[model samples]
Target: MSMTLALRRSIQTTPEQTATVFHGRRQSFCRFGDRVARLASALRTQGMGSGDRVGMLGVNSDRWLEVMMGVWWGGGVLNPVNTRWSGPEIVYSLDDSDTGILLVDDHFLHQVEGIRTTARRPPLLIHVGEQAVPEGMLSLEALMAASAPMDDAHRAGSDLACILYTGGTTGFPKGVMHSHGTLWAIGIQRLAQTPMPGGSVALHVAPLFHMGGMGRALVQFIAGETHVLLSSFDAREVMQTIERERVSDLLLVPTMLQALITHPEFDCFDLSSLRRMVYGTSPIAEAVLERALDLLPHVAFTHSYGLTELGSATTNPPHNHGAQGRASGLSRSAGRANAGLAVKVVNGDGVELPRGEVGELVVAGPNLMLGYWNKPQETAQALRGGWLYTGDGAHMDGDGYVFIVDRLKDMIVSGGENVYSAEVENVIARHPGVMSCAVIGVPHPQWGEAVHAVVVRKPGAALEAPDLHAHCKAFIAGYKCPKSIEFREALPLSAAGKVLKRELRAPHWAGQSRQVG
Candidate 1:
């Protein structure tokens, strides 16, 4: 079934129920459906065609969700831009996807000029913020008001839904494409694993551009629950929203969870309304988990594990976080495969490994992405023999619990964002003073892992950390830039002359039980 089916059902069954809450604004299912229809009509009038790609570059808000549904309602594809990326990076995605219409918020107005100058064909700009409409750009409200409500296009099954960009090992980002069928499968699998309570209200803290955030939002919509949105993650604001809205559900990463539970005025707010939380994208520190379990004894905690290529393959239920499960060490597992999904560890030759033997994790399910956009070779490498190679080194116990040990790919998860080491190293190696460099993820207190760089300087060159920092800032996002830098005369290398990143990362992860945070 198409995702729009959820909205259609909500409008038919509970038109007066609250659909979205953003800041002080609230919209009922009836009103929300009307706005979505109008927006879809506006998009069609603006020349959006069936299967065309439309991009939304903004923070999380009611309008963001509206645009997402409207695009599909109008029979168009969605390409949600990464809010943290630099101008060039954003341009690359827009150009790569051939997005013809782009929506911008107040927070991203500064990027418009860069996009216009650099993009192959600059998209038609529509201002979605509360600020005064910019010259030569159309106002979203005006367009919606001018257009009449339109019918749902009923796009479903193999029809493309979204193109989500993920960091690449080739110093570029690749677009991961998903169809309506795949997304519908993910929602069904999630619901079958852990059902949402009736009248559950979910507060979104993670960016809507992320799979973790968007995937959970899909599940909530499928369950016909109320949504409360925050433009970004703010500990105090999250606490206030939960208390005021009586939010019962949340989807947060380890970093956001830590910030919320460790806030100075954490106890000042009445957060008793929250009942269930799902955390993923990075491993949680044992100390933080213990503290949270103690502080929020009534809340059920679940851990999820998945990737953009394959949405939500496994979910550790709340029972695994309790005292009994902790004593049995089940808390460390990423849980078994969700309903209708299959996960297995395999050797290098695609042969299944024995249970308890560490190997690459592969998943097979209806939730697997169609493929990477415009990259047939990469898609083949990722999806082979009806299985998606996850690039995660893991082992499954006899009971089917999967434990992640390391990343087979040169990638890092810091503050719930994926950073490719090759992408960062590419930016650093561009510095004329740097002879060689390697990027690795180091243990971090707040971000779970931090991007760290080790550089070998050119003889007689005065390359400092500040110089490299400034250089990287020009090409990549701030989070992808190195949090710390160290200089060495020579880097440890193998016989093949490849830098041994394991040695460099070992010092920083000395006491960590696993290579990943």
Candidate 2:
């Protein structure tokens, strides 16, 4: 019913058990619960009332978990800002959600001034970093130390818990709202499908801001498992942590898995403790999957498929990655729908398509998001007739396995991040170089898909790739910037005068098995 219930249960049953490990700092369940309560008390003292919004801008750390639970405990909704975004993007999300109290770490101190100057209503700043607190910001450590521990607010069942921002087709990010009930339902569904082992130690390398990372963390908490935190993903650091902490579970994108398996000293680490590995965000290459299976024969692999709006919809179980499943071509599919969830491929007219027919994937489940915050029309478009119309081109076989063939939305998944082509194109169009552009994803060896832009320059103006790249970096995140740019006199267009993105992406993905990465 409520996420905080998990914390209370752990405190009652296993108060002495280790709950969190980060950079040599470990906290038991009892200590963690007390800190969370204190932080919640501090938030309440800072004018955060029930249903108020609080934003956090930081990487993965023990404090991140505390802030998340503390907000819920204090009856506030969480808005976890994307660290990779530029100042304007972050400001848009915070301002859109009307977040009043913003948490910052040392890594993002430089952006505080810009946020204060640009945000419609500047928020109160709280420092949650290891470094010394900034002059004007309140220190989280000081607040927790000074405030008295408070009781949980007991907000549960349809109470708004989080507003997660996802890349939007309208050249901005949209806040996807998820209630406590929806999130709790998804966690239970995942557990029912693949139960975690007792005394499991989960390693957190994925960014906590994204759904994939946050959902996995929530499941670990629901199961009362220990967590090993990492500030960010570094190949060597991840391997070292796995060996040192004896990590039993992990979630990764195919790109991270590739980097881990191909590390020069990968075999030197004693990764025998690792028992389960769940990968998603993008399909894995056949070669990469085979290599990982050969190297970690003891590990069970699962591929999870879902969106921000619909939390874990389907999961390709461990057996599907084995020899028999591979021979049957099941390894290439995204697996069946999760328990209590319904999935089907529907045509453009909202009619369900027959099996083996590629169409847009639609899902109906309790895990579906409440709606996009403050955007009624968009929400209506996404959720209609009791099904969330996922903009993914896929098909279901007779056995109910879903195989994603392409993306119906003009979005690209690169290195586990969603990059909307419209967002990138908007930034490029602002350049004085005066041009029209189309952005698409190209086949990439490591990133799975790389952002590629095709542009037609103004007749008299001379714009180069380097200049455009620098221009884009000034306005958008580095990962969304084009990895390659092509200049042309004219771009291929359709009868409707829309630029043909499929034509732009065709040559690059000539022989790939799937159009999507």
Candidate 3:
């Protein structure tokens, strides 16, 4: 179940299928597979081996897919660098992963141009952009052109496929090691659940480095569907692409959905080609989701739940949100485990608690990543008894729906009381003046950690702390209300659209061993 085999199969099954569309060029599956094979052979000549890590930092493009497939075909591991990170932050991941070959698009070349002074510099550079390789970097086009296409390595099981770096407790990103078996299983399962026959166009508007975008693209690719690539999300461009390409499926975050639904020209666009609207990464405020549902009546909404540790689209059963009895279960739940995945909610002592008890959700399944790369201790702690202990606190109801309460760390401990930040954030988002908000734990001399909120207001709205406090007080307990508030033009967000509460709470924990709970 190597991704290489999947690519080869797509080419054989439907050679003429549009494998990728980026910057107005469409490449067929057969041509895409041949490029991948030649690139793999070229990378092999350049010293990438079975488990060697190859770092990629680039804007999304056809080349990203080509190089990623090339890495796998070369029997190497991919280490996808986050597009939004400081130079030191980027360097830290390269050092931690010991990546030898660093690939970069032109937009990010300036970031690594002077990284050689560091002890952990990548040995080689592959330029993945249009313009000529700037002076010293190896030309990506030349490498593929010089090499001959190679055959399958035939690794159809749990071999390390890619290392996706995600933010960790160490205050830097941890590399998540996903296997070929796991990645392929999740992709095939998604295609089985939502069959994308040959002509179906899958839009990759989400960043490819993240799990959701990667999963969505793979699912469509395995079925020989057209790939509509978007470098970065633009709400207007998303709708325009749908109309132009006759896109069938789109993976979106709640933030993107809000922007699209509220776009002034949304009503004017021909969006009927869209059949599925899958959302996750973060919870959507109820009103925003409801409004989106009302606006796009023809599309089926599938709420996905999973992180990089467990591949995205973990649980996406077809559901009708308006159905009276089903709505109560599905709306508040993150659906049941998708095929090849198993989920359980466990207590602090690691005992599997009975249904309806709010415990830390743990997943034991094929979709779970192999482990955290280069962090054996952290990996062992996370992968206990074959289950990945997701920090997310959740409870499974009788019908097996997972209700995510909050992250065990994000659950506020205030004066001996447990307050979930997601609970407070949900309430704060209800305020008309609030465009977005993140609840974080701050220094409290008496209570240990006090609830603090950073808010981004709606454009042209007059908002005051007192008014916001009163608003939250109406919906949730006063203890969970923000004791301090900071107004920002925009909140810090990860590629997946998750609010970085850790970054927001950094100042408060400067001199102490920070407690997440």
Estimate the TM-score of every prediction.
Answer: 0.99, 0.99, 0.80
**C-alpha RMSD by candidate, in order:** 1.0, 1.0, 10.8
**Model 3 regions more than 4 Å off:** 313-316, 325-329, 410-517
Query: Any residue pairs clashing in model 3, and if so which?
Result: 1-156
- lDDT for each candidate structure: 0.93, 0.92, 0.79
Q: Positional deviation of 226 in candidate 2, in angstroms?
A: 0.3
| lDDT tens readout by residue for model 3, 250-295 | 9887668878998999988899999888877764556667888789
- Residue 373 alpha-carbon offset, candidate 2, angstroms: 1.0
Task: In model 3, state the lDDT of residue 426.
Answer: 76
What candidate 1 gets wrong by more than 4 Å, as runs, is 515-517
Judging by lDDT, tell me the better candidate of 2 and 3.
Answer: 2
lDDT of 2: 0.92
